[model samples]
Target: MLISRNIKMADVIHMNYFTLSVLNRFGIELGFGDKPVEEVCKKHNVDIDFFLEILNTFVDKDYFPKKHLQSFSVKLITDYLQTTHDYYHKVKVPEVESLIENMVDSCYTQKENIILLKKFFDEYKQELLNHTHREEEVVFPYSLAIEEAYQSETPDKSVIELMNNYSIDIFQNEHDDIEEKLFDLKNIIIKYLPQPKDTGLCNRLLFVLFNLEQDIIDHSRIEEKVLVPKIREMEEILVKNFAKK
Candidate 1:
């Protein structure tokens, strides 16, 4: 079911606990009582439409409101994306790393295999860091700049030069499949890695890895499906307008 403003905040959590992370990204905490989603969003000063869209998209895999998401300002989208990056960096990555560390420490047999697993994850994490760093430092700013230029009555000539040098198509082409490695990591644990002494620890590590993988998939969907196309459209408009000058 699609989430509505009238739905109770607590009920939303009951519907999809995964949304707790989504709520956290919006700075919405757990003590919302029985307040409706709209009321809670207003209290938190979040854009209600954007919040609902994000929640629905996460809740139902088939429910991507691409046009609706594209209607939001680039800044809003980028800000949310940045918050997601922060969550991955500060919380998810560390939680996964810690679990893997615990698993490695607790397991006695096949220690070398576990160590190699850790090495693989470390490489994946570094690649993820590089991807996000480039998005934050280069892609997002360029997207925002396109929006600014598109909105400007008299866009600076520099924007044309910027677009000429770097376009959204370039970003889409260079977008890496970082989550693919997570799939391999999961397969390694599930298929190849011998059962750890602490089955619980291994299970926890797999669970965390799965969650991170899904989260990254959703994150990439928003970027590639929504943000990239929106910026591309804006870039096209800006180019045409500049050409008329």
Candidate 2:
């Protein structure tokens, strides 16, 4: 992973190329976060437990902020609790609540709110959920697997090289796509919440969307700069071991 403060929020995997096939297969409008785990699992053909374990890992790492119960809304927290089976209950619920409140007050109150408010919320939820699932299930596991393969006594150099090269090429390509889509979505939202619209609801919706966008960008950076490189290094180690054999 190439660590730098340079990458902005829009340059993540959705903007990249390799994951584009998966993203297109998965579709971008509805996003992966809003759908049920079972549904996302079925759609992506990922394992549920495996997915849960990965989410739990990230949550534990505080890669995600713990949902602040005192400051956040109850309903949002409750929804997350139900969805994640309390795995993120203590950490994510509060933030989820705050997001819900902001979205309801800001985005849902606009004149155009009725047209796509529900859709927006649904997509928002699905996008976050799906993002987490992808990292935990597909991306992380493959990464860890590559790392382990590189560390084994009799490392499989061919497999290590293939996985490393493919992951880097594919994941980076998808990051570009994610960025473009997010930029388009942001533009659409901004149009809907044009300036001088001082409604309390409009303010909240725009704020929430802006914050969510920031989170997505930051998360993508971590994966690209941190996770991707880490996995590649591990693959390199495996190759070195193979040479010794």
- Among these predicted structures, which one has the highest TM-score? 1
TM-score for all predictions?
0.94, 0.47
* Candidate 2 wrongly placed segments (more than 4 Å): 1-113, 156-166, 176-186, 193-198
What tens digits encode model 2's per-residue C-alpha lDDT throughout 24-122?
Answer: 322233355545545655666544433332233222334432222122222222233233322332334345456445554554345355345446555
Over 4 Å off, model 1: 66-71
Best by lDDT: 1
lDDT of 1 by residue, 116-197 (tens): 9899999999999999999999999999999998888988989989988999999989998989999999998899888878
For candidate 2, which ten residues in a row score worst on lDDT? 1-10
lDDT at 202 for candidate 2?
Answer: 47
- Candidate 2 global Cα RMSD: 15.8
RMSD for each of the candidates: 1.6, 15.8
